[model samples]
Target: MTVDNLPLIELPIIDFGPYLDPSSTAEQRQAVDHAIDKACRHLGIFYLVNHGIPQELCDKMSVIARQFFSLPFEEKRKHKVGGEVRGYWFTTNAEDLSNIPCEGIAFHPPVNQCSNGVAPDIDPASPEARLPTTHDALGGQHSWPNDHFRAHAEELLSHIVPLKVRLLDSISNCLGLSDASRKLVQNTVPHIAFNSYSSLTKAQMEEGVSNLVEHTDPGTITILTQDVDVVALQVKDSDGKWCGVKPIPGSFVVNVGSSLNRFTGNQYVDTLHRVIHCSEKSRISMALLADPVFDVVIEPLPECPFKTDLAKFVPKTFGAFYLDQVPEDH
Candidate 1:
């Protein structure tokens, strides 16, 4: 189905209030579920309102993020660890789309500390030394500009992480898999990024340089919110036309990702999107990308409504899937 045919304007506005309310009626909850299902299968994107995340917290997060991004390049890059997954990555006119022209910092669960205070005999440079045997290779201690930044980031995540769990449950229900889908997410280690895309210079814009090239997120789900009035996000429809998604105040843009797309046997759309310069001001957005744990198999759910005689894809571990999507440099 083309995006034009969907019963929505640009994107559906879903009231997550019903899903979070204990007193909401069954029909009210079902209405929420149906709206999510339609959006996922048709466009894989929607504007989520009444999601219960405090507006003040969101505002504070944006404020701190901009402060961090506005710091001197040397001050910010002090925490950057080369060839590591969990640190600041600053790129300028990247040769390929894999790394766009932006400044980004990622936060991940920390590596486990040895309880006995004795370092293992393994080589410190080896993968085994940096990550636990059970962790995704991406798992490690995060690098932050300072404790103040870390505190606010974690506080925001404290609220978002739990909300994502509930969202996984809702998507599971939409797929008719009940708790099965939720179970896959139990061990998920989320990777969230605070990214800043500086406005294109007049010369760059005239040269048709891209800020973020068209691509689909590889995780199970991506929850994103950008600074107010920074309208650069664009979604591509089935007909190959791109439409800008206006940022709604206090609402998050949620979309199904590749991992979830494969789980449903490609039944749901994993929308393609990109970013372009909208104004002279820079753009800052927080993206929380959630995927299953390292060892979890990503296969079509047996209970999904779209299950067919032949599986659409071969089963692969989420870790392997993630590795395939990473660029060679990092």
Candidate 2:
């Protein structure tokens, strides 16, 4: 028999240790896979604990994000990466999105810029080494505030990219897709966002003004690390009620995005979520958005157990789907 959706009244916290362990039995790994599949189908989101990313690395990421966002707007904008997709972006309350002011910096994986998809020559001293031509939408120069920030950020990517690959492999197994599906996104560049949101006033909070508007992610999946002390993130549950995703120390939030939902033939819900300004203190989060390679055709695989004859989504390349769905301002 196939699996059923899990209850979505509360956010599910999944222990990923078993899947991460080489000595784990088949049943142990399968249990984790089922839990992930259930969470994605019913709530589209869950918290992952004991996922093998070091606490020191998480702490370092949090510290560096806070330190960089704390800088003055003028100083921060100086390093703007400048594109619809990458670099620094600061929006005024009137410019819209949430219709509230916010600050963020985006970076793509190093492979995006390097032709070989590995080992980019980003030596600071070699100014001419930076690629003059971008490979695709995923390829671009990543501007940074300083050498220190770049080092840590790149280090985080080195760890998290592998995590993304491993997680995708598990998801493929859950959906009964071939092992080849695990590498469907191997060439894609995942975008990393370091976001900062300021606390709103009592009047604004009372007005139900969201710091980020409700929307589904357009990519395949998102793995997010947020401030442990904050409680502003919320996800729309199966019943349509918004549920808060409370911060868990040393954990990351993983959610299905629209592309993955389509790939799974709508079996996995594309999560609708937003951030509200409820805290007196400001909040910061680091999110890694993973997508398939731009040229990937997004039709459901025949091996996917959830795929039906009357497919709900039309076939399209990942690049085309992204352009059609995502706003350029973002």
Candidate 3:
């Protein structure tokens, strides 16, 4: 079938059951590869099924997220800038300023090292003590009221971090890397965020005022779990048409980010994407941004680099590149 006639629903939903099975047959591996190729090509998006994250847990997380966002503005503000690692952010607090119009890209800058104001009791050397900065704005202390939210947020991280590692391995395999070469991702430090967009009025939706402007994610990989009925996410198709991505119940969307594009020497495409504010309902989403550890070197893969002139390309450490592009606080 022609690309247009093939299916209105062209996005791929990949099943991970085969990868988890000890006795998985060769055909199963081939099937997985096929899915990965298609997802990386036609649309830089995919639905992951059988990923082992419990449906009940996802539902509970969603409910709690809704509750958290529903709190009075003042109560929610208790977790605002300048406290510990957990809190809330208002609309327009974090954004990317580099885009000429800053239309679709919501860039959140990194927390500045000096002003983070982390508690004295929490040692900086501790792995768990680092905080995700407020969206590309000022990096000061996170203002969380108590320990309850902190504990739950940590629990969610515990569940998803390893899954992210495994998925990265699968991605590495798709690039024909050896098992040991998967080490390319080992030292990566990933950031995760739970964000809820306030419901927009019909007029706001029509004007695209509450919608996220188009931009590509800057990290290596991004995995997102979104509200089932919310239909605001959209990606540019090969034909440059805007296509809506409907959330699949019990699945997450995975997309490659800019870092991965550089690592693959641009062999794999990292497509542009954005979100529209829901007109009929508010939307909640959990986003995970995974990148190599600060010290890990990011160079183009050997095979892919030779095809393009390596001499003209610029090389910068992953951390340096990310910090440079952090969205300026509005």
lDDT (CA) for every model shown?
A: 0.74, 0.75, 0.62
The sequence of per-residue lDDT tens digits that candidate 3 reaches over residues 231-327 is: 6677788888777777899898988787777777766567788776544466778777776554345677664453356763477766566656654
Clashes of each: 0, 0, 14
Rank by TM-score, descending? 1, 2, 3
lDDT of residue 263 for candidate 1:
81
RMSD of each: 5.9, 7.1, 7.3
**For candidate 3, what is the TM-score?**
0.76
Error of 2 at 151 (Å): 1.0
**Of candidates 3 and 2, the better by TM-score:** 2
Runs in model 3 deviating more than 4 A are 1-9, 82-87, 93-146, 178-181, 306-313
How displaced is residue 284 in candidate 3, in Å? Answer: 0.6
- lDDT by residue (60-130, candidate 2, tens digit) is 88788888887776678776764666787765453443323467888864433323244245763575353
Error of 3 at 286 (Å): 0.8
- Displacement of the residue 92 alpha carbon in candidate 2, Å: 4.1
